[model samples]
Target chain A: MERMDLEALNNELLDAVLEKGSLSFVVNRLHQALNKGVLICDCLGRILIGSNSEIEYDIDAYIAKAIDHSEAYYYDQEICQLFFPIGWGKLIAIIIVREVKEEEIENILPVLETANLSLCFYFSKYNAIREVENKYKDLFIQDLLFNNILENEEILAKSKLWGWDFKKEYFVAVIEPDNFINIKTFAEELEYITKKLAKENDIEIITSVRSGTFIVISREKNNQKERVKEMIVEKISRANKYFSEKYDTTFSIGVGHTYLAYKEIYKSYQEAKTALAIARLIGETKFVKYFGTLGIFKLLYKQEAYLLKEYYYETLHKLIEFDKNNNGELLPTLDALISNNMDIKLTAEALFIHVNTLRYRIRKIEEILRIDLSKLENVVNLFVALKIKALLKLHYSDID
Target chain B: MGYGFLFNIDACIGCQACAAACAKKNDFFLGFRRVQKYELKYRGKNVVFYYSNSCNHCENPECLRRCPERLYFKRRDGIVIHKMGECRACLTCLKACPYQAPKFNHQIGKVSKCNLCVDETGDPLQPKCVKACPTFALQLVHEDYYQPMAQYYHLPIDTIGKSHITQPSIKIIIPPELQKNGEN
Candidate 1:
C-alpha cells in the first residue's frame, strides 16, 4: 500500500470513529468502508455489533487466544480477530473480521489496526468527557452543600437538568478512610463502590468527594426520622464491611439529621461535620455517629469559645494554678471524685491512693477553692466545668 | 475598532446549537460556550430568556490583568487569546472576569476559554458559534458597527470592577418586551 493511500484510510477510519454517532452506527460504517464483515464484542466475548449473522465463529475462544498471546488471531481466510486493550490490560472490546482474501491481507491488517487504535482513542476521549462532566456535577453539589448556591429556584432547575430530585428530603453523610495514602484515588474508588451499593439497594443518593472525604446526600422518603436514621446506619455499616474486606480500609461515617426541604440541606451538612468532630473527640467505638445522638455535646459545642474558656478559668483556675506551682494532685482527685459519683471510698480506690491521702487532697481542693464539695450545687458546677475543659481540649487539639 | 460577537437575544430560540458547535469545534468535553436559560416574572407573565455567551475578548480584559502567570495576551486586532501551556490553573482569572469566561478544566488542571476561533476567523471565516446558529442570532461584527446597536440593546457601560474598566467588546440585543419591562 502507498503512504498516501494508508493516510487516507487512517483519516477515514478516525472520522468514522470520532463521528457523533452511536457505536453500532460507527461499527456498521467501518464494515461498509472496509468491505469486510465486522463483529464487535466486549471483553467477555458477547457480540455487541456484528455485520455477518450467518457466519459461525467461536469468538470467545478466539478472544481468549488473542489475549493470551497479546496479538491478533487469524483462523484460515474465514475469520480474523484483534483485541483492543485500553489503558493497561483493560480490554475495551474485540473486532472480528470475516471474508478476507490472501492478497488483501497486508492492506486489511493496517485497516484493522487503524480501527482498533481509533476505538481505543474514542473510548478514552469518551471517558475523559464523562469525567469532566462528573467534576462539574461535583462542583455543583459542593456549592449546594456549602450554601454557596443561594438561588433556590436556580438550583432546583439546575438539579433537574442534572437528574437530581431536589424535591426529595435529604441528609448528608461524610465518609472518611482511615490512614489513606492516595486520598484522591481512594475517594474515587469509594464513590464507585458506594454508587454500586446504592443501585443494588435501590436508594436515591447524590454523592461527591471533596477534600479527601466522600460525601453522600441520601434521600429520605420515610416520614419517620428514626426509620430513616436506621436505614442510613444499616447502609453505612454494610458499606463499611465491604470496604474493609475489599480495600483493607476502615471508614468512619458521620450522619446528619434528615431535613424535609432541599433548602435546609446545608444545615444537615453542618450537622454531619459536627458529628464527625464530636465522634472523634468522645472516642466513639462505632464507625457511624448520628448527629442526634451527640446530645449535650452539640449544644455545648455551639457556645462561643471565649465563654467556655472564661468558665473553665473561673471554675478550675485555682486548682490548676496550685497543681502547677506545687505539683499537687487536686485536678486528678477532682476527676476521680466526679467519675466515682462523689463516693470517697470509690474515688480513693479508683485513683490508687490511700483513703487518708485522698481526704487530704479533697481538703486542700475545698480549702483552696473555698467551695464545699459536700454541697450538690458546688459538685455539679465542678463536674460541668471539668467536662467543658475536656471538650475544649478536644476542640483545640483537632486540626481542621 | 476590531471584531466582536453580537448576540441578538430577540432572535435566539434557546436551542443551544451555537453552544454545541463551539464545544465540538474546540474539542471541549465541558465548559466553552454556556447557554444559560432563565425565567423572570414580569408584568404578571413568566418570560424565559436565553443567554449564549463565551469570551467577549474585551478591549480591556480583566483576565489579562489578573492572570498571575501572564497567560493572556491581546492581539493588535483586539482579540484576547490565552497561552495554553503556561496556565497554572490558579483560578484568579475565573474570579476576575465579571462574565466568568475562563473555565477551569479539572481533567487538564488548567483554565480554558474561547479564543474567538482565531485560527478560523484569521482564515476570514466566522467563529464556529456565529456560523452554527440556526436562527442567525450570533454575528461577528466590527466594534464600529456594534456601538449603535449597543445603545438600542441597553448594553451596560460598566460592570462589577469599576466604570468601564474592562470595556467588554461584545454587544447584546435584548427583546423589546424585556427591555420595556426593564428585565436584565
Candidate 2:
C-alpha cells in the first residue's frame, strides 16, 4: 500500500481541483481503485457528487454524526458503512463508503485518507475560485454603475450568472469612510454587516467596492418609491452609527433615486456618486445626503462641460487671466469675499489680509472684470461659476 | 509583510543598464523596462532627474482586482505575477494601474508585465534589475526599512486613484535637488 504524500498531493492537485469535472473524475478514480461505492456530500449531507450505488442509501444521520464529531466512523457489521470528514472545522463535507468488508477496512483506510485530502483540496480551491468570480461580478456591477457602454445581452448574461435580477427596481447607495487605512478589509466588513441587516429587514442588496468607495444596489421590495427611500435611509443610518462606533471612524452615505430597469440604474449610481461628491465638498458635518435634495446643483451638473466652461470664462476669465499673468491673489480674494457673504471684514479675516488690502484687491477685481460684488445677481453668478469650475476640476481630476 | 524594492534616484546615472539587463533576462521584446529622464527648473537652477520604476507589487493591487480574466496573483512574499495564457486582452488593468506597470503585448494580443523575476529567482533574492544595476541604485529591502525612507523623501505615497489607492509596495529616494527645494 502506498502511503499518501499529503504535501505532494496539495502541490499537484491545487490547480486541478478548480478545473471542471476534476472532482467527479477524482471520486470515480478513487472508487475504482478502492473497489467500493463512493459518495461526496456537503456539510449538510446533501449529495453533491458520487460514484456507483452508494448514493441511494439514507446515510444522512451517519454523515451528520461524523460531521458533528469531525472524525471518521465505521459501523462494525455486515455491509459496513464508513463516514470520513473532509475540509476544516465548521466547513466540511462527508465521504460515505458503503458495503465495506471488515478484512478490507485496513486496506481502505489509506485510500479514504487520500480521498479526504482530495476533497479538502477541492473545497479550498472551490472557495478561492468562487471569491474570484464574485470579484468579477463586482467589477461588472461597477461598469454598470458608471454607465459604461455595455451591451444589454452581455449585462443580462453576467447578471444572470451572478444571480442578480436587474429588471427589477433598484437604488444605488454610496458609502464612504472618513479615514479608512485598510479599505479592502473595511469594505468586506461593511458588506457583511449590511447583508446581515438586509436579511433581517427582508431587503435584497448587491454590493461592490471600487476605488475605496462602497457601492450597494438595493432592490426596492415595494412599489412605493418614497417608502423605499425612507427605509434605505433609516437602515443605512443605523448601520453607519453602529459601524462608526465599532470602528472608531465616521461614515457618510449618499442615496440615489430608485429606477426600474438595469440600464437606468446607472443614472442612480451617478446620482449617488454626485451626492457623495457634493457632501464631501460641502462639509463632513452632514453625514448623509440624497441626490433629490440637490436641486440647482443637479441641473448645473447636468449641463455640458463646454457650455459651463464658456459661462465660467465669460464671468471670471479676466480675473483668471490676471492671476495667471502676475501670480496675483485676486481669485482667492474673490472666492473668500463670495464665501463670506460679501462681508469685506470677514473675507479679509479669512484671507489673513488687512481690510485695506482686501478693499484694494476687490477694487482691482471689479476694475478688471467690470462686475459689482455688491449686487445679488452678480454674486450669484460668480458663486455658480466658481462652483462649476470646482465641479469641472473634480470631474477632470478623477482617475479611472 | 514581505520585501519591497528601494530605488535611490540620486545614485542612478541614467545608463539604462538595469533596463537592458531586465529586458535581456526576461526576453522582453516590447520593452518592459522603462527609464524616464525628466528636467525641472527649481530656485533659478536647472536640474535633471532619472526615475527607473517598474511594478511596485502593491499591497492592494488594482491589477489583480480589475483583471477580467483573473490572471494575476500575489506570491507569499508580495511579488505579483500574471499568467499570460489567461489574459483576455481587456487592458483594464493597464488603465487601473497608477504607475502604468502592465504593458500590452501587441504581437501576442495580451498583456504582460514585470514579475520581479520570481521565476528566475524566488523571494529573499535580488531581482534581475536590482542585480544588474552598475551604480548599486536598486536594492531589495524589507518593508520596515523602506517605509521611513519613503516618508523622509516625501515621495507621494498615494496618488489620487493609483499608487495611493492600491498601496504600492515600492519605495523611492527623492532627487537631492528636489528635496532641497521642498518639491517632490
Clashing pairs in 1: none
Go through the candidates in order and give the clash count of each.
0, 1
Q: Put down candidate 2 lDDT per residue, A231-309, tens digits, no spaces.
A: 7666666766555655567678888888864656766765676677665643443377788887667566445555766
Q: Give lDDT: candidate 1, residue B161.
A: 17
Interface RMSD of each: 22.3, 12.0
Give the backbone clash total of model 1. Answer: 0
Kindly give the stretch of ten consecutive residues in candidate 2 chain A with the minimal lDDT sum: A391-400
Q: Against the hidden true structure, what lDDT does model 1 obtain?
A: 0.68
lDDT of 2 at A245: 54
Q: Give the lowest summed-lDDT range of ten residues in model 2 chain B.
A: B153-162
Query: Which segments of model 1 are wrong by more than 4 Å?
Result: A1-126, A148-153, A177-180, A222-226, A237-251, A277-287, A302-306, A313-383, A394-400, B1-184
- CA error at residue A17 for candidate 1, angstroms: 11
